[model samples]
Target: MTRMTRLTKWLLLMAAITLEVSATLSLRAALNHPALYVVVAIGYIGAFTALSFVLRAGMGVGVAYGIWSACGVALIAVLASFVFGDALTARMVMGIALVIVGVLCIELGSQAAHTRQTREGEATP
Candidate 1:
């Protein structure tokens, strides 16, 4: 598989994240009014399409999924409080912070493994 450059991969991942968040928000809007289902479906389609591109760019599945899911959960929670008037409690804030930390750990671990493999390859005859 041809790997994309890190910048390209990150850009794709960001796009995927944005689309996924938009989809989740649209889902909320759709719940109250059935006519908005089309918007929700389109948003989901865009999200998955972008995510597939991100995966194809050779990002590790675990890292990509961890970041995607963690960020999505956090973003949705905050957005819900603003858009839906849902309460954002202290517990929710703490949970979101933990999720961010977990995703960062996954990303850092993936990067370390890649760096080690590159160093090993360079050391070989």
Candidate 2:
């Protein structure tokens, strides 16, 4: 693919991540305030839509979802802590760091697997 195409795909992937993050926050809000259920539902629906576009841009579902969810979870944890005044101790920060590291490892592994598969596919042809 051309550089522009690759960039576009990446942008879409980021959009997907953004949507998922928004949906998570909205869902939390809706849960607390039943009247916001419709807004939350819409946010989630938009999130899935963005995710679908990202997949269409050629990202594997596992890889995409892993990155998306990890980011969303991390952001939501921090946001929730701030919004709810939940304890955010040093240990909690350490745990979040670990979560990020684990997710990065998963992304790296998945990327390696994807590159291998692409090489194999090329060789087969």
Top candidate by lDDT:
1
Clashing pairs in 1: none
Worst 10 contiguous positions by lDDT, candidate 2: 17-26
Candidate 2 pairs with clashing backbones: none
User: In model 2, which regions exceed 4 Å deviation?
Assistant: 31-35, 121-125
Model 1, residue 88: C-alpha shift (Å) = 1.0
lDDT measured at residue 41 in model 2 versus the true structure, 0 to 100? 72
lDDT (10s digit) by residue, model 1, range 1-125: 23447788888889888888888888888888888788778877887888888798888889988898899999999999999998899999999999999998999999999999999999999
| Candidate 1 weakest lDDT stretch, 10 residues | 1-10
Q: Best by TM-score, which number?
A: 1
lDDT for model 1, on a 0 to 1 scale? Answer: 0.88
- The residue-level lDDT of candidate 1 at 77 comes to 97
TM-score, model 2 to reference: 0.77
